[model samples]
Target: MYFERAHISDGELLAFYKALLYPRLVEEKMLLLLRQGKVSKWFSGIGQEAIAVGATLALDNDEWILPLHRNLGVFTARQMPLQQLFHQWQGSPLGFSKGRERSFHFGSRQHHICGMISHLGPQLSIADGISLAHKLKKEDKVSLAFTGEGGTSEGEFHEALNVAAVWDLPVIFLIENNGYGLSTPVEEQYRCEQLVQRAAGYGMRGMRINGNNLLEVYHAIKEAKRHALHEQQPVLIEAMTFRMRGHEEASGTKYVPPALLEEWARQDPIQHFEGFLQFLQLINEEGIHDIREALKHEIDREINTALAEVSPPVSEADELKDIYAPAPSPIPPVAGAATHDKRFIDAISEGLDQAMVQYPNLILMGQDIAEYGGAFKITDGFVARYGKERVRNTPLCESAIVGAGLGLSLMGYKSMVEMQFADFVTCGFNQIVNNLAKIHYRWGQTADVVVRLPAGAGVGAGPFHSQSNEAWFTHVPGLKIVYPATPADAKGLLLAAFADPNPVLYFEHKALYRSISGPVPEAPYTIEIGKANLIQTGDDISIITYGAGVHWALEYSKQHPQLSIHILDLRTLLPLDYEAIREAVTATGKVLILHEDTLTGGLGGEISAWIAEHCFALLDAPVMRCAGLDTPVPFAASLEKNFLAKTRMHQYIEQLANY
Candidate 1:
């Protein structure tokens, strides 16, 4: 049996069949544009039209839809203007993000389609987040996130399902198994025979549907949405569809077997649905032809409108804008808050407590955040203090943890989520890099999330646990990377992050948690996020550093009394303190950079290059960099010391001495 002959009504068949045809032909037009060289790339939802259009028809106009790059049918059936899609293909700025996003990668905050995430599995977690927000906000809206079979391999996919299941969030996770992920088949992608089987691990109901059958897809989505909204439990729908085209426009069907293609072709969602419509007798042959032509004309008109829209021109200002939303209420005067007589960890603990109070919507969610108090006990006592509702102790799913944070933030809550270790943040890379960082830029500030990581390499925590990956987050736009050197800065930065409209990556140095104690304010306060602190003022050399580097620089400065050093601690890395850096390097005439991250593509190179470009005339010597050797931080305390920047800081001072 090529397709399932379910109890689908004639009227339903007609509606679904027409849906399949209209979108298929519209997608074909896009293919023509691609062959004509009018579009750069084309990813048509050819054979898999039913899953896209059918699921959407069952969904409310207001329900959130997170489509993958291949769900072109969703856009076509949902009446997304064609000209805009064409403009996106044409690489026109006007088309790229008229409001939400370009063609295949799109979402509408107003329409409740939370933007599309180009990176696959992240959207699944984000869908959970959006669903969580709807529950918290008491909105009736449900979130639907789609991904391919290959996306299930990502940690984010599992994380999302588990979290949604645990919290009973209103999210529908649709797995579109199109047989191949790029060139890799579903069999090669996973050890599990059926992708839906994994849902049981999360204690969620899972269903598999004939993806080419519009009726099956529609009913599955409807049932999934019902479970999400009424039961408040997440549902996973595995739609076994086929990819008629290659992965992308440039790709060919050479890798796929002709027999399988022909077999799936008979189950062609569009053609099958068209035949179903004829069987139902809803419309004659002429009526179907008229509707098809009407859709083409409508799509063409939309495309033209998209072409006429305007986009911001490429300029240096585009780089600066949207990094940080106007700080919530301008920075108050530096009126000193009362100092709290507490230990470093105590200060952080109290600060987090006070932060939750100040911002009632703020939540503390992470693995063991409620009961175990996090791996490092940073979130210890939080669950008991905030209750299970706000202080959520998540399963050990890093991708879901971050994805849930992103979703919680979207619901108007300031979600402070923690990764047990900085090294583990890599597991949630799809959520962090693609979903959290780009959400604001793509969907226009729909998600305001804060991700806190216990980072750096001083802890003899071994290779997997000890890593400084701040440089990775810093590279992504729309993310604010903060590495607080002091417990006071940690408290202040975390507070500021809660107030931020954009996403913030607050990296706390693990070694500095208890080792470094400082005067923490008893009163609520937030330091300027992007501003760098000029700790020690001297004229000979400028030491540009951050995180643990700030502490190391101070140590080096103390050891070298004769040498005059100007230490600039970049509190924020993404929107660097370029103005302060330019002034300091100009005044000092010599520059020395330091960091604990790997030397390759580290922040040191960027600062050093900037000085060479802007402070060339002020320089008495070339800008020097001191960073960890390009190797994994060794486990032994002594070996780790030699492999990290703290050990090499003195050597840098010696280099600055000769210069």
Candidate 2:
């Protein structure tokens, strides 16, 4: 029913007035509730209602919108049930996030809405990702993302804009240029005369308009959407508006000039739109009064109904629900599956080759991955086989690409991101920890994303290139961590990670890429994650290790042939394989945990503590660990050899076995 027209109608003008007024009234009522101690917090959109209403209404119903906390009109204009919105704000279980999140902290796939997180700029990349999905499917749809002037200062904002421009993604990057960002003035924010000018640097269309003009915002967004979809390129739009209230009720606006407030007050968007409706003879002053009363009554009833809806009793089950979706039902490996010898990297590459064929919607993104293959050649010849679209080469924007992966997952595509080095994951840490890992737990939405981390040492790659930082992500919830040692596991576990429905951090040791070779399945197969491989059973000490440490354990067993050493290869680090760990500890009665990460905060600390607590009576010796020194990875070979825990644990374990 909403269409972009050259000539306006009386009915359409009245509808816009109503749409603008609705969120204004709702925000006002929410503030009153906050004063009465009924609502927890409020971010008012009193003067800026026009921006949300205009843009959301202008976009197609099936298209997506990413709105910030101040954009309540985005929800109402999209026709989301008022009761549900109220219930969400009130943190009631009947709400969209089931009270797991509050305010605009949740998203609804059914509504095609992705709510904004506190980090304002990451969603720019997410919008780019969703737009990427539309382009991949050849669907003529566009996504609109909103941010404030302050959010534009984030590096992710620049990264996202550059990525969209390069890929020609169909997304509208709308900067809601509210004069202040949490009391910070526009003069202090940036030196540019206007934000839209930066669009030229990224090679995109740019537009700026007075956000107080509801008609202007509507028309601009409609045209921007049209341009994005038809031209197959993104557009940057800066809506020049003012924040007429405090950032939140608790944060008063003492910094804002009284004269500035008065200036913007006279330009109130809702009042101006209502005046247009009256002038058009669509509604009189008395009719305006009647409509306001009706809207107020409807909101009051919706609030009351939401309040009366009982919040479900808190339970432990609620606390643990949906942290992960069910692990994808895996394809059964053939009984006596045909096998062939392949290097560790070859197996991984082969597994990905089979995966690309199996999942047509699968995407592989990294730096120089397309025609050049990859930095490590793990994706050699992938572009020629899968085409440039599926096998993508990304800019040096780890943060944005990770966020885009989540966006792809949102639109029902499985995504894989290759971090050039494991230590480089620090660049994309926020996207991984705050965004990807927390999305599922906050909402019911799970992402099928895999980040391949080339981690480990002994290759003389130095600190930045050689790091086993899988422990960093293992601490985060809603993420699965897997590290494989042998060629077979390198292949099987990679396939298994792709099969899992949650976000997975797949760590591949650079040291084992070619050094390790074994007979691996010729066909696509998966090894169940969280299940340890029992290398050998012995009555002596149990060596609990993963990744490169598995090879260390095997070598130690050979050196100390007299000692009965039981080596357990923990392929999946997150799940811990508790049953296998218990079995190993019970059988050996002594435990040695080893890892390449530093001794201070490595995963071995947790594993050692767990074994100590659970298997105390069964222990013949104290649970010990051998991990890297508490310092940066050394650059020199002698120092690196001394810094590593390769043979340090062997002597202690032999003593313990003898003891």
- The list of candidate 2 runs beyond 4 A from truth reads 1-5
What ranges in model 1 sit over 4 Å off?
1-18, 96-103, 138-141, 190-193, 304-313, 319-326, 333-337, 457-459, 556-560, 598-600, 629-631, 644-651
Question: What is the TM-score of each predicted model, taking all chains together?
Answer: 0.90, 0.98
Q: Write the per-residue lDDT of candidate 1 for residues 360-459, one digit (tens) a residue.
A: 7887778777888877787787776777878887787887778777767666667877888888888777777877777666646545677878888887
Model 2 worst lDDT window (10 residues): 1-10
For candidate 1, what is the lDDT?
Answer: 0.78
Give the Å shift of residue 399 in candidate 1: 2.1
141-165 per-residue lDDT for model 2 (tens digits): 9988999999999999999999999
How far in Å is the alpha carbon of 202 misplaced in model 2?
0.5
User: Model 1 compared with the native: what TM-score?
Assistant: 0.90
The 10-residue segment of model 1 with minimum total lDDT is 94-103
